[model samples]
Structure formats: C-alpha cells, structure tokens
Target chain A: MDTAMLIEKSALVLLLFLISLGVAAYQTYFERKLAAWIQDRVGPDRAGPFGILQPIADGTKMFLKEDFIPAKADKWLFIIGPGISMFTALITSSVIPWGTNLNLFGRDISLQVADFNIGILFVFGVVSIGVYGIMIGGWASNNKYSLYGAIRASSQMISYELAMGISAITIVMLTGSLSLNDIVKSQHGMNWNIFYQPLAFFIFFITSLAELNRAPFDLPECESELIGGYHTEYSSMKLGLYLFSEYTSMFVSSAIMAVMFFGGYNVPGMDAFSGNILAILSIAAFALKIFLIIFVIMWIRWTIPRFRFDQLMHLGWKVLIPVAIVNMLITGLVVAWNQGWM
Target chain B: MSLQMISVILGSLTIASGLMVVLSKHPIRSVIYLVITFFFISAMYILMNAQFLAIVNMIVYAGAIMVLFLFVLMLLNLNKEMEPETTRMSLFTAVIAGGTLFLVMITALRDTFQYGKGYVQVPVQDAGLVEQLGKLLFSKYLVPFEISSILFIAAMVGAVLLAKREKQIID
Candidate 1:
C-alpha cells in the first residue's frame, strides 16, 4: 500500500480508538448526571467547571489505587478476563460506519475502519465472544458470587443474542446487504427502515440494550441479587476496564442503531451542501444522533426498574425471539415482493 | 516452506488440544481445552482459504457450543472429585483407539496429499456464502429445517414435563 493510504488507515484506527475511549469516559459522567436529574438531585459539581473533569478524576482514582488479586484466584486467567472484555468491546466497533466517504487530498476515504461485506455477522460473532470475558473473569475470581454472576451473564447473553441476531436478519432482508455502510446508504433521505420495520427496530433496540447489560436488563450485574455480579471481585483498573467496556459497547451499540435505523448522517437537505463544510457538518450530524441515542439509553436506565430474572428469560424466549422470527419472515416476504421474486 | 511449516504447527496444536480435551479429568478444564482446539481448527480452516467456515467454526463451535458446555459444567457442580477415574483396561483401550486413529489419518494423508497443482486463487466474493447458504437453506434444506423445528418443540415439551414439580395430596 502507498504511504498516504497506510497513513489514512492508521489515522482512522487511531481516531476510532480515541472516540470510543472518550465517549466511554463521558458516558460514565453522563449516566450519573442523568440518574441524578431523574431523581431530582444535584450531581457532580465539585471536580472542575461543572464537574467536566469528573471522568479524569475517576480515571486517576482507579489508576492510583492499589491493584489487588485474591489469594485463591487464578492470576493469569484473572488478568486475561479484563483484557478479553476490553479487547472484544473495542474490536466490535471496527465494522461500524461513522459517516459517508470524504474526499481528502485527492483521495476518497470511507468513514469506517473496515467495510467487510459480512459486517453485521462480524458484529454478532464478536458480541458472542464478549460473553467469554465475563465468564472467565467470574470463574477465575474463585468466588461463588462471581461464578454465579458469570453463569447468569453467559446464559443471559446467549438468550438475548438470538433475538438480536434474528432482529438483524430482518434488516439484512430489507437492505439485501449485510455491510453497515450499505444499510446506511439504503436508508438515505427519508427512507429509514424504522418506518417500514418498526417492530424489528424495537426488537433490535431492546435486545441491543439487553446485550449491553444496561439497566432493567442488567441482571448480570444486579447488585441486589448477585452482589455486584460478574465484576464483584474486580478492583482498581481491572474493574475500570469492565465498567469502561460496558459503556463503550453501549456507545457503539447506540451508533449502530442510529446508522442502521435512523438514516445516519443524512439530515433533511443534506444533499444541498458541497465541500469541506458539508463533510464536517455530516460528521457532526452523525455524532449528534449517536449522542442523543446514548442519552436516551441513560434515560431508560434511570426510569425503568430492573426486571425479575424469570421475567427477563420469559421476555427473551417467549416474546422477543418469536417476534423477531415473525419480523424476519415478514421482511423476507416484503423484500421478495419488492424484487418481483414472489 | 512457510505455508507448510505454519500448517504443520497449527495442525499439531489442534490435534494435541483435541486429545487434551478427551484426556483431561476436569470437565471444565476439558471444555476450555476443547475451545482452544476449536480455535486451532478455525486457524487451519483460514489457512485453507475457507474464511467463512473458519468464522462459523469459531462462532458456533468455540463460542456457542463450548459456552454451553461450560454452562452445563457449572450448573452440574462437577469438580475434580466428582469425576471418576478410568480403569486400566479402559485407559489402555482408549490409547489403542487413539493410536489407531492417528495411524489411519497419517496413512490417508500419505495417499491423498498433493501440493501446488491446481491452486487457483478465487476472487473473494463478499457475502457469497451467506447468500448461497440462505438460498440452499430455504429451498433445498427446507424439509430438514422444518424437522429441526419440530425436534426443538419436542425437546422443549420434554424439558417442561421433566422439570415440572409435583405437589403432595393432603389426606
């Protein structure tokens, strides 16, 4: 590859890494503030300038703290646990499309790290691998609570992931493409799939939340039952990696939802602009949509009470999976009819 | 030299781990080793230019199947003490079976193996397998698919019947 292309690829990777890290950091602060606002209380105003530096302070605290490994814990596996969690979280975002292609220095550049044709499937594969992180971490901790949490997490994720995959199948049928960029392009203008496949959208959105272990569906880490769940024994930056990965995955999921269903980067009259300003504006619009989606997730977390474990299982198997399957069938029928293949 | 050497190394790792999976006393540890075996097998698949199969192998076998194994192990509460020791005769039979299998595989490889004859590099078609697999599944494999659904329903019913609690009658 040419130097310029190599440079661009490296820059893209670096940019995505920084964006995920930054968003994950702020999401922690954002969740707290949202929770406080919903409960009618002041939140985090001491750190610097309206507590804008709170994440920094939190990072410092985690870093400066003493890292502890339990005496009975498998030290290598314990270390691998957080490493796997953080790695899977970051790698899953590689296939997500951030914006349309931009022309820079006489070369066209796509606003994605990779544009694999099986992008959606890749995401599913990576997300499935994510369970191993929790399972290993919990198992290696050598605590009963941790082990229970791990088992719960593995089962929960496996169950919810089926619904998520089926929901994605609906979109794949509608778009006739698995690439995230292609899906975004298909949803260009005012033709968002959300309008056509609202049921699928809802299933995908809810399942995405569950997959991220967000509130209401956060049974894996349900403090009331499992005592902080999977990461109960984790401390210092090991715990921070777990928490950061959760929020990062949340941020990436929000972005995926926006790109897949919300006409990503395509505002009304977006075609009217041309040149550098338009590119910048489009990227800004995409970022705004992602941020709004993240805010809505946090809002849901603060509003909804956690579900009973049995209720969560019932919703997954008896409700979401069947609904998703039906939606996929409908989508396939619609696509076939549209293509005159009936 | 390079491709052959890499394949040999990966193949050895895969076979060794596959053996470890069966030989390991601890069920949980066996599952872990089996996962590693799946990973090595996937790597071998990738080396053979079967990217789709490699990914599916990792996802279905290593990721999902082994997680199920680990989950079952955890649920059963089976640890080292719970596992039964193999009798000397059983161990001997297992070793003989393993040795015979290895010998057969080596002999088969010696007869069938060929290098660099018709190695055509096919263009990587994006979503090719997914599209073809979807067509084959919905059309040619429809009967099997429907049968599988019926099987799943039967299993669900069986599980419910087995797990249902019975209440004692008051005299």
Candidate 2:
C-alpha cells in the first residue's frame, strides 16, 4: 500500500474508534434523557445546554470514583473481563460497511475498516465472543449472584444467536452474497429487503434486541432478583466499561438493523444529488436511519418489563428459531423460483 | 521477515495454548486454554484464505461449544480445589502418549506430502463458502446430509430422555 493509502486507512480506523466511544457515551445520556421524558421529568438540562455535556459529567464521575477490586475476586481475570467486553464490542464494527466508497485525493476509500466477504458471519462470530466478557467478569467476581447472571447471559446470548444467524441466512438467501455492502446495494431505491422478507425482518429485529440484552430480555442484569447482576462487584471504570459496552452493542445493533433492513444511506431520491453533496447526503441518511433505530431501542427499553428466564429461553428455541427457519425456507424458495432454478 | 513469519509466530502461540489445554490444573482453566487454542486455529484459517471457515470455527468451537463446556464446568463447581494433582506415573504415561501421538501425526503428514507438483493457481471467486457447502449438501453429499439429520434427531431424542429425571411414586 502507498503511504497515503496507509495513512488514510489508519485515520479511518482511528475516526471509527473515537466515534464508537463517543456514540456509546452519548447513548447512555440519551437513554437517561429518554427515560426522564417518558416519566414526565426534565433530564440533565443543566449539564451544558440540554444535557449535551452529561456524558462528560458521567465519565468524570466514573473516573474519579474509587476503583475497588473485590477481596475474593480473581484480579487478572477481573481486569481482562471489561477489556474483552470493550474490545469485542469495538472490533465488531470493522466489517460493517458504513457507506459506499468516497473518493479523496484521487483514491477511493471505503467507509468500512474491513470488507471481508463473509462479513455477516464475521459479525456473528464476534458477537458470540462478546459473551466471554460477561461470563469471565461474573466468574471472576466470586459472587453467586454474578455467577448466576453470567450463566444467564451466556446461555441467553447463545440461544438468541442461533435465531439471529438463521435470520441472517434468510437475508443471505435473498441477497445471494454474505457481504454487508452487497446486501445494502441490493436494497437500493425502494427495493429494500423488508418489503419482501418482513417476517425475517421481524425475527431479526427481535432477536437482535434479545442478543443485546436490552429491556424485556435484560434478564442477565435484572436488579430485582440478582442485585445488580454480573457487574455487582465491579466499581469505577471497570463498571463503566461494562455499561459502555452494553450501550455500544446497542448502537452497533441499531446500525446493523438499519443497514440490513432500512436501505442504509439510500435515500429515495439519492440518485438526484450531485458530487460532494451526494456523499454528505448519503452519510446523513445513514446516520438518520441509525439514530431512528437507536431511538426505537430506547423506546422499547422503557416500554416493556423484563421477561422471566424460562420465558426468554422458550422464545428463543420454540418461537424465534422456528420462525427464522421458516423465513429462510420461504426466502430460499422465492430466490430459486425467481432465478428459474425451481 | 514478513506477514508469513507473523503467522508462524501466531501458529506457535496457538500450539502452545493447545498444549496448555491438557497441562492446566483447573478444568475451567483448561477450557479457557482450549478456547484460546480454537481462536489461534481460527487465525491460522484466516491466514489460509478461508475467512468463512475461520469465522465458523470461532462461532461453533470457541463461541458455542466452549461456552457449553464452561457452563458445565461452572455448574459442577469444579474450581481450583476440586482439581487433583497428577501422580508421577500418570504424568509419565501422559507424556508417552502425547509423544506417540505427535510422532504419528508428523510421520503421517510427512508421508502424505506432495511438494511443488500438480498445483494450479485458480482465480479466487466470491461465492460464499455457505453457498458451495449448500450445493454440495443438496447434490453430491445428499445421502450423507440426510443421514446426518437422522443422527441429529436421534441425538435430540437421547438428550431429552437423559435429561428427564425419575419421579417417585406418591402413596
């Protein structure tokens, strides 16, 4: 690679890393503000112009707090726990195609950090690895409640992941390629996959929510029963990392949902835009879709109560998995018929 | 000296972790080591230009199967104190067995190797591995695929039966 290309890619990676951290931090503030609004109260309006600086305040609080390691905890594993959570959450975005290639200084630069052909599968693999952070953190905490929470989180994520994978399979069958960019391209103009594969979309949407362990599927961190759940013993920035990773996964999931189903960055009349304006418009379109999805997630979090553990497992195995498989079969048949292979 | 040397270094780390899987005292630690081993294997698969297989390896082995093993280990409470120290003779026997296995693998690999002949460079295609695997499953390997389904069904039934606890008759 040329020096400029190397520098560009490095800059892109750094930008994405910073953006993800900022998004995660602000997502926490957003959730709090939304929760406040829902409950008919003013959120952190005092913290720098309608709580724009709330995330900064939160960060300061977490950093200044005393870092406490539990006496019974495994120190090395404890440190590694949050590190794994944050790393996995951050790295999963590398394969996601944020927008089409942008031309800069006579070089075409892809918005994504990496574009592996098996992008969707890479996502599934990375998401599964994310379970280790919670599991290890819980195990290292040496608290029974944390251990229980960890087990719940692991099993729940694993079960929901199968349904999530199957849902992605339906999309793959429709698109005929595993690359996220190809999937996005296939959904150009009004040709979004959601129109043809609504069932698959619903299954994927719900399963993604479950996979992220947001409200109604947030059994792992159910405060009523498990007493702060997996990260009960974690204090200061270690705790912040766990919480930040949760919101980061939510943001990433929202972005994935938007890109996969909502015709990512593809406005209805986007073809009419010219030159630099087109690029900026497309990026704005993508950002808007992502924010909308994130808002919907926050809405659901405030709307629904957590499910019972057994009920959560039943939804994954008996309901979502079967629905996902049926969607896949139907999608496959449709694709085959359209291609005259049937 | 190049990316190949970096891969070689990674491969050695993987092999070391794989060895640690058996050598570790705690079962949980062994499971962790095995997970790391799977990760290393996945990295090697990436090096071999099999990104799909590498991701699948991580998803299935390091992610799903290892999580199950960890769950079982945790459920059984097989932590540090539960691990028993190996006797000298058992250790000697393990070493012998490991040595024999290594020798057999090396010899077999050496004997089966064909160097710098009948190798053709083909243009890389973007046909997702899943698509090719699906085609193979439905065509050339249909019978084996069907048989595997039967095996899976049997395994499911066996699992349900095994998990069903016996109830006492109330008088």
Candidate 3:
C-alpha cells in the first residue's frame, strides 16, 4: 500500500471514530429532548442554548464521578465489558461505505475505512460479538438483576439476528453481492431495494430495533423489571461507556437500515449533478438519511413500551423468522424470473 | 514483514488460548479462552485468503455457539470447579494420556502440513468468495449440500421432540 493510501484509510477511520462519538453524545441529548417533547415538558436548556452542550456536561460528570466496583464483582471482566461494547460498536463503521469514492489530488480515494467484499457478513459477525460485552458485564457484576439482564440481552440479540440475517439474504439475493458498496450502487436512480423487497425491509426494521435493544425490544435493560438491566452495577465512565455503545450501535444500525432500504446517498436528480459535486452531495444525503432514521428510532423508543420477555422471543422466532423465510423464497423466485431462469 | 508478524502473534495466541481452555478451572474462563482461540483461527483463515470462512467461523462459532456456552455456564453457577484430589496414580495416568494425545496431534499435523507439496503457500484467487463457493457447492457438491440441509431438518425435529414436556412425550 502506498503512503497516501495508508494515510487516507487512517484518516477515514479517525474521522469515523470522531463522528460516531459525536453522534452518540448528541443522541443522548436528542433522546431526552424528544422524550420531554413527547411528554409536554421542557428538557435541559441551561447548559448551552436548548441543551446543545448538555452532552458535554453529562460526559464530564460521568468522567469526574467516582468509579465504583462491587466487592464481589470480577474486576478484569467488569473493566473489559464496556470497552468491548464500545470497540465492537465503533469498528463496525470500518466496513460501512460512507459515500462513493471521491477524487482528491488526482487520485481516487475511497470514503470507507475498509471496503471488504464480505462487508455485510463482517457486520453480522461484529454485531454477534457485541453480546459478549453485555453478558460478561452482567455476569461480572455479581448482581442477580445484572445476570438476568445479560441473559435476556444475549438471547434476544441471537434470536433477532437470525431473522435479520434471513431478511438481509433477500437483499443479497436481489443484488447478488455482499459488499455494501455494490448493494448501494445497484440502487441508482429510483431503483431502491426497499421498493422491491418491502417485506424484507419490514423484517429488517423490526430486527434492527431488537438488535439495538431499543423498545419494545429493549428487554435487556428494562428498568421496570431488571433495574437498568446489564449495566445495573456500572457507574462513572464505565456506565457511560455502556450507554455510549448503545447509541453508537443505534447510529450504526440506522446507517445500515438507510443504506440497505432507503436508497443511500441517492436523490431524484442526482444524475444531473456533476461528478465531484455529486460525491459531496451524496455524503450529505447519506448523513441526512442516517439522522432521519435515527430520529425515527428514538421516536419509537418514546412512543412504544417494552415487550415482555416471552412476547419478545415469540415475535422474533415464531412470527418474524417464518415471515423472513417466506420473503427469502419470494425474492429468490423473483430474481430468477427476472433473469429469465424460470 | 507486518503480515508475518501478525501471523506469528495470532498463531501463538491461538495455541495459548487453546491450552488455557483445558487448564482453566473456571468453566466461564475456559469458554472465554475457547472464544479467543476461535477468533485467532478466524484471523488465520483470513490470512489464507479464506475471508468467507473467517467471517463464518466468527459468526457461527465465536459469536453464536460461544454465547450459548457462556449462557449455560452462567446458569450452572460454577465459578470454580471443585479441585479433584491429585492422587499419584491419576497424575501418572493423566501425564501418559496427555503425552500420547500431543504426540498424535503433532504427527498428524506434520504430515498434513507437508504431505501434498511442502505447504502450498499460493493463495487461491476468489476461492473464498460467496459466488465461487456457491457455484462449486451447488454444482460439484450438490448431493452433500442437499444432504446437509436434510440433516439440519432432522436435527431441528429431534431438538423439538426432545424438548417437549414429559407429559407430552408420554402421551
């Protein structure tokens, strides 16, 4: 690899890291603001102009507060849990294409950190590893509540992931490629996959909510029964890490949903724009779509209540999985028919 | 140089974690070590240009199976196993069994590594891709592929049958 390529990749990685952190921080503020708005109450406004700086203040408090560890807790695992959560959440961005490649210094520069051929598979694998953080942290806390939350979180994620993968298979079958870039590129003009695979998109949306532990699928850390769920024993920045990872996952999942379903970086008259202008506009368009999806996720969180554990499991397996399988078969037939194979 | 260095690191870590899985007294610790071992194996698969296998290894084994292992271990509540009294006879038996297993593994691996052409290092181009693998599996290995699907169906039915309530089973 040339120095310029290495530097470019590193720069993209760094940029993504900063963007994820910033989004996560602001996500907390937005969630609270939205929550208050829904409830007809004023949210934090003292910090900086309608609580713009609230996240910074909240972050400072998390860092300054005393880091607490339970006497019976396993020290090493407890410490490692939140770190793993944040790490997996952030690294997922590496495979996600931010926008089309841009030309700079007479060279083609990719916007993504790493454009692996198995980008979607990489995402699935990384998402699966995220369960370890919650499970380990919960187990380490030596709290019954924590353990219960951890178990719930692990089971729920695994259950939903199957449906999620099956639903995504329809898209993969439609596109005939696993690379996110290829998936996005195939949807040029007004030919988005969501229009073609609406059922798959529905399943994906619900599964994404479950995967992120957002309500009504947020049984992992349901405050009513599990008392903060897996992060019950976490305090200070450790707790912050857990919360930060949640929003980071939210951001990542929103991006995935937008890219897969909502014609990522696409606009109606995008073809009319010149090449370089289109690239810049695409990035902006991608960001706008991501935030819009993020807003919808938070809207659901406030609008809906948490599902009972059994109800969550039943929805995931009995309902979604079967529906996803049927969708997959339908997609396969359609693709085959379109290709004149049948 | 960097690639080789990464390989060396992953290789040693894999062996170490594999050893830890057996040596650790805590089952959860062992499971963690086993997961680490699986991750290193996946990394090695990536090194060999088997990216599909690498990701699948992580997804299936490290991600899914290991989480189940962890869940079961947590439910059992076995933080530490009761240390079996180390009798001299048992120690001697263990040493003999361990030595024999080690020797067998080493001999088998040695032959496997150099048998067909002294460790062919050429990476198969796009051999690990989904399209390439799918074509080969659906055409060349169609029978086995279909058989595996049938096997999976049988296994699923068996699982459901076994998990039925005792009253249901008796009925």
Candidate 4:
C-alpha cells in the first residue's frame, strides 16, 4: 500500500525466492550424497569437501555448455518449457507460512511472501499446471520418446490429482479453512491435523511424491524405458532448469507438508515464549522441520524402486481416491459427533 | 484510477490473446494462447477480490482442461498448419455470424452497465469465497449440484464403455 509497505513486501518476496533457489541447489548435493551412502560408496569428492560444491560445478558446466535447439523443434516453446517449470515451482511457496510475524524497528514483519486466503488451492492450482512444462517441453522436442514421456507425465498428473484434491479436502474439512496460515495456526502446540487425519496425511504424502516426480513415483522419467524422458532433446541450462525445478518443487512440497501437517514453526510450549525471540526460534523450527521432511523424501527415493505404470495408476485412482473419500466422510462424522450433531 | 488502469491492461491482454487463439495457425499455439487468456481473466477475477474463483479458474480451465486439449491435439498429430481455403458462401456466412455476435455483445454491454459503476464501484462481498460459495451451493443450489455430479458420472461411464472395442455377440 505505502512505500515502506511495498519495500517490505518486495524484500520478503526476494528473500523467499532466494531461499527456494538456495535450498533446491543444496538438495541436489544432498540427494547425490545420500544416494551414494545408500549404495555404500564415496561420491563427488572432487569439487569441494565430500562433493559439497558438486552442485556449483554442475551448474557452471550447464551454463558454459553450448545451447542447442533441435532443427525441427518449435524454438520459442522449447525455450519457455523449462522457464514455465522454474517459474511455477518457485511461485508455489509464496503462500507457505515460513514463520510467525516478527517485531522489528517498530514494524511487524510477516514471514510469508503473501498470505493469500486460499493458500492450499493456490498451491494445487500452480502444481497442476506444472505438467505443462513437461508436456510442452517434450512435444517441442519433436522426439517420440519425449512425446511419450510427456504424455505419461501429464496422464500421471491427471490421475493422481483426483486423489490429491480429495486428500486436501479432508485437510480443509478438518481445519475448516483453506489458508495455510490458518492451518498452521490451528496446530498451536501439539494439535496438528495429522493426529486427527492420519489417512489424509499418508494419501497426501504419496501424492506429493508422485507430484514431485521423486523416486518410486518417477514414471515419466523411467530411465529404463524412456532415456532422459521429456528433456531428451534439451541441452545446456534448459535441461538444468528442468532438473532444478524438480528439486525446487520437491522442496516446496516438503515445506507444504511441514506447514499443513507437521506444525510449521510451532514447538511444544512455544506460546509461552512470545515476541521477536519466539518468532526467530519459530523460523528455525520451521526450517528444521522442512529439512527433515526433505531428508525423508530423499530416503524414500533411494530405498524404494519405481512402480509399474499400471500399478501407479491403480494406486492413485482405486486405492488413494477411495481411501481419501472414506477418510473425508469419517472425518466429517467425527467432527459432527464432537459438535453433538450425531 | 490505478485499479481501472490495471484492469484495462489485463482486459486488452485477454482480448489480444483470445484473438491470437483463433489466428494462430498451429493448434498447440492456439491452446497456449487460450491458456494465456485464461490467466489474464483469472488475474481480473483476483482484482475483483474473487480469489476463489480466480484460483479455481486457473486450476480447472488453464490447468486441467487445457492440458486435456493439448493431449488430444498432440494425439491427433495435427502439428502442421491447416490451410483451409475460404469459399465465397462460407466467407459470407462467417461475416454474417461474426457481425451478429459483435452487435449482440455491444448491445448487451451498452444495456447492462452504467459506465464505471457497474463493474468497479459495486463490491461483491464474500461472493467468491469458498465458505460462502459452499454454504450457498449446499443450501440454495443443492439439487442442481447433485444432479450435475450425477451427470458427470454418467458421462464418465459412457465414455469408458464407448472407448471399449466390442466383441461379437452370439445369439
């Protein structure tokens, strides 16, 4: 509204974007290290200590390489595909409550970029469009495998989104609000929604894995079948953006899970500690929760193998959606019973 | 003044993109332009404080429906431009239909609005919110909602059945 307010909001927006990028960058490093540890081998020790700077090296290589577009490809669309992926991935985190409000210089600073009313819907909406990146990218490549990969990717999204949306309905039903901030606030100390909606949490977690294209659900990029998948024709930084956006979406989904179910920024007896001190500590708590979730995601990636395409579809449509619906009905009944309506 | 200016920009972009949707030779390009137009329309909805409608528009139309369109278009393998030659009768019919639609739209706009007051000054309180919408639907529009869902289920079942290849029936 005012100049100071504009500046503060802009600052928060920039800070959030940088944090997403930074975390996504480090995620690559961490995933590789974790994968190596899973296989009982030392990995990427050349760049920095224990390959900590491996991501930086990989990034530089991507940037300095020759950018090539296939001769028959739609040039503009090819370029914009990864851009769309990166943009959507980065923007989805804007509504996630990073921490509580802070008091500084006689001004209260909200940690989130912008706390929209329908925060969960905003994430879902952006996430649904994420498939366009893979779809258009593969189509623009003019390669058959790329097209097949894109088709698989989009169909997979279309299938899982039903279960994902239904699962979120249970959350929204339990919280009685669509805003992530309200969702987080409702879980003050130990009253997280996961305690009440365990089934929804499980359904949501699996859908999130499929949504992020992490291992066990990475059907679109199944290397055995479709080599390089959607980005088979893409080279240089464009491919890098595709890879980076995956990790970014992974981090964002992890953050979303942390906020929605894991009591984001809320520690036990956190209400007792008030003021800026509490706010700072809450931020740390939120980050720690996010990192733990991301670690678990990587663990899942390495430990479990990918599912067959039919099995993936069956799980999403038959198992998860029905379970989510039953979960929602039971949650509604419980809430009604609590309110003496039953 | 600022809101009106932003609306004007968004409105022009929507129209331009809509035009591009038709004018683009490639079907995929048309789909992309339509998606762009939808985004602009969603932005206008947000400007009107209809955040739920805005995000739902993005989710349903730009996200899900457009992806379906892309999949179908790609499957048809119609990537090359279609060069349809316009005949005299066809051109005349097109012009007549376009003229009639344009006149109807202009008349409707002129009849419905009192210039700026109609769209800007009047605020729609809680109209676009989920809770308000849900309560209204469940109360006043319950029958229609249920019926529509049943209709969707029917259509889905019909599609699945129709998609299956038939086996010969032995009488």
Task: Pick the DockQ winner.
Answer: 3
TM-score of the first chain alone, every candidate = 0.98, 0.98, 0.98, 0.98
TM-score of each: 0.90, 0.92, 0.96, 0.94
Candidate 3: deviation at residue A185, Å?
Answer: 0.2
lDDT of 2 at A9: 81
Candidate 3 Cα deviation (angstroms), residue A169: 0.3
Candidate 4: which stretches are off by over 4 Å? B81-100, B113-121, B164-171
lDDT of 1 by residue, B18-108 (tens): 8999898667678878988988987876676656667788889877988998888767867667677889999999999989998999887
Alpha-carbon lDDT, every model = 0.85, 0.86, 0.90, 0.89
Cα distance off (Å), candidate 3, residue B147: 1.5
For all predictions in the order shown, the interface RMSD in Å is 1.2, 0.6, 0.3, 0.5
TM-score: the better of candidates 3 and 4? 3
Question: Residues A33-60, candidate 1, lDDT per residue (tens digit)?
Answer: 8888999988998999889899999999
Worst 10 residues of 1 chain A by lDDT: A273-282
* Model 2 TM-score, 2 decimals: 0.92
A best-first ranking of the candidates according to their DockQ comes to 3, 4, 2, 1
How much is B61 displaced in model 2, in angstroms? 0.4
Better of 1 and 4 by TM-score: 4
RMSD of each: 3.4, 2.9, 1.9, 2.2
User: Which pairs of residues collide in candidate 2?
Assistant: none
Taking the candidates in order, what DockQ does each have?
0.55, 0.80, 0.91, 0.88
Model 1: runs farther than 4 Å from truth? Answer: B1-27, B44-49, B77-79, B114-128, B132-171
